[model samples]
Target: MRSAHHPATGDLSLPEVMAALSDPLRIGLLRVLADGGERGWGELRAPVAKSTLSHHLRVLRDAGVTRTRQEGTRCFVTLRRDDLESRFPGLVAAVLAAAEADGVGGGVRLASDAA
Candidate 1:
């Protein structure tokens, strides 16, 4: 288990957060993180390559939305839940709501066919 103390202010840049959240993969990552308490990178089963997942995690870390720590050779990630809620109330909730509205369950969305 990795422990971290979130920075109250100026830790997460707004632009970086926006950029990180803009990508669907990153959003999926966030959703996954929300599931387990703290997750090692290996716990993720994202369809993308390990390199790609690394990039996404980096983005989230830089954005201050997540705090990562190295435990031995493995990296673990956890959402900066407190800081995030303090910085932007209901933001994460809204995202979760949007996902629910979009019909995503257990972080996976069922596809819809269009004509």
Candidate 2:
């Protein structure tokens, strides 16, 4: 299988990262990933179609907010927590805290939450 392109930690741009986090759905995804565990693509749940979810994942990956690994036909994703922290210094934590304070992902029903 072909490998996915991930920008180097140094190559990650603030504008791109901010833009990627601009969407509520993407923030919801981040909230799920913030637990610091890698989650399979099939494991994520959202109100949108699979294609739309895929698009959001791609946006996060391209922006360097997350890392995606392909294992055979499955794709697993994890938030690039260390890299993001190193690059931006507490930005992820602040965003996540703010998201929680504002109930950002409260409406998005994740598969794990359904269990």
C-alpha RMSD by candidate, in order: 6.2, 1.3
For candidate 2, lDDT tens digit of each residue in 3-68?
Answer: 989999999999999999999999999999998999999989888899999999999999999999
For each candidate in turn, the TM-score is 0.79, 0.94
- Where model 2 places Cα greater than 4 Å from the true spot, the runs are none
Give per-residue CA lDDT, model 1, range 1-115, as digits (tens). Answer: 4454444555666676778788777787777677547887777766677798788888888788888888788888888867888887788888867865774434422122121
TM match of model 1 to true structure: 0.79
Assess the local accuracy of residue 63 in candidate 2 as a C-alpha lDDT between 0 and 100: 99
Q: Highest lDDT, which number?
A: 2
Count clashes in each candidate, considering only residues at least 3 apart in sequence or on different chains: 0, 0
Off by over 4 Å in 1: 1-8, 103-115
